[model samples]
Target: MTTVQLEHPHAQRRRTLVRGLPLAPAVVLMLVFLLGPILYCLYSAFTDMALTGSSETSFVGFENFRKIFTSDEFGRALGYTLFFTIVSAIIGQNVLGMFLALTMRAGGPVARAVVSAVVIGAWVLPEVVAGYLWLAFLGEDGPLNQILGFLHLPTQDWLFSLPILAVSLANIWRGTAFSMLVYSAALSEVPREIEEAATMDGAGTIRRLVSVTIPMVRRTIATNLMLITLQTLSVFGLIWTMTRGGPSGASTTLPLFAYQQAFQLSQLGYGTALALVLLALGGVFSLIYLRILRLEDGVR
Candidate 1:
């Protein structure tokens, strides 16, 4: 018989503390860097802080929130933010990515490699670079107009006339690869035998995809939606570089509007409040996605 010794609770705790010592530096750094700034921002949102003018900061309770809620600019920015997120991330990237993944799955290895390379090449570019690229592409005298002119079609100044759409399309082009990669990974995990069984049951491609593949990858879809929605909500550089949220704030999302308030107008407190609202919006989206995941788990 082998002799076994049980460890005391104090010994176990001591060993655990020793093991956790390695993470202490990381925890301290996060508190100072991440949590510290967040706390400061939370505090600042209620104050009358400014980027310029008086150095004194005074807390004004919910005045900032009330002003923001009543402001037309904020409402417009909020609407544009929702439009951008819904059109670009939720619909465009999600749909296009799944389509690309399905197409690649049905294609030869060489075709898949070529398509992935081309798509990911666009994705890998820095946001500023992508924005500039799209700006030039959609500029009044750019190649798109040139093509339209060549086809004898009327050409409009895309950036000036349809700034939001232009930015949304640019975002879709830039961000779709992430969704494609995520969906591709999810699709790979789905069993081939199940798909074959569905096929044997006389299910067409669309039916199998609708009835089988989508259900299997539903969790991944929700996760991707949450990530992209949050990302789209915070997009500033791309829109800034492309249109500067302009042609009269047509493409000004919350992030750009917040920047305008914080830096341009010197309203730091208002900007912090806007930032908090954006954070709350992201949190709402995360919670919804989490609920979906939980429901899926319950169903399983």
Candidate 2:
């Protein structure tokens, strides 16, 4: 015989406002710092802005984007960017990290600790430092060449002959630890009883991994792929320190190209347009991953 009382709509609104008051500063900061620059960049991408030689900035409509689409350099840079992202992040880091996680899961504690330490040491290195380290390692007179000489193996100048490959390998080495950590956590949450039941049903290791373990961790894998892809797409310091997108622009990705155009060539509008394109590329990747995740959820 108890009656439930309903609050008035105006009081409810006032209570909600009171609760939201504490978030005002953070909301204002985001509007000022985050939304502000994004809006400014959106505006700048359409203008004929430059660092010098142009006293007046004129609205260029799609002129800058047209220049980007028509430019050979932009095409080359876009191709390299895709190559780097796919090779280093999608395939290399993702596969190697999964392998390491599986190995550690099966190995003894000592082995797991040692491997984790080594992998995370590389991961924790600053991007510039890692780039320089790889640069020295791949240099002609570096230890890698010396080791090749000792083994009576051929060792050409790796950085010169395969600049993009070298950088991709460096990125893979530095980034794999993150994926490993992610998979390890996800794997730990997998039900041991389910795995044991699969074992009892005579499923081999590979079969169990493919059919059971992978399905369980698919969400994590997709999330990790999206994150690492975005991070790899934005990589600048590592590539800049290692190659400076040099040796005839063979390794030039969009970020390097944009920087070169904006600062060196003083084509700020074109560079901003390029930046927007890169952002759009990232958005596309994110959308694909999100779509996959939603589909997975629907299936579940």
Model 1: colliding residue pairs: none
Show where candidate 1 strays beyond 4 Å. 1-8
Best by lDDT: 1
- What is the model-wide C-alpha lDDT for candidate 2? 0.94
**Per-residue alpha-carbon lDDT of model 2 for 1-300, expressed as tens digits?**
746559899998898899899999999999999889778779989999998964999999999989999999999999999999999999999999999998888899999999999999999999999999999999999888999999999998887899999899999999999999999999999998998899999999999999998889999999999999999999999999999998899899999999999999998888889999999999999999999999988987
**Model 2 regions more than 4 Å off:** 1-5
Relative to the true structure, candidate 1 reaches a TM of: 0.96
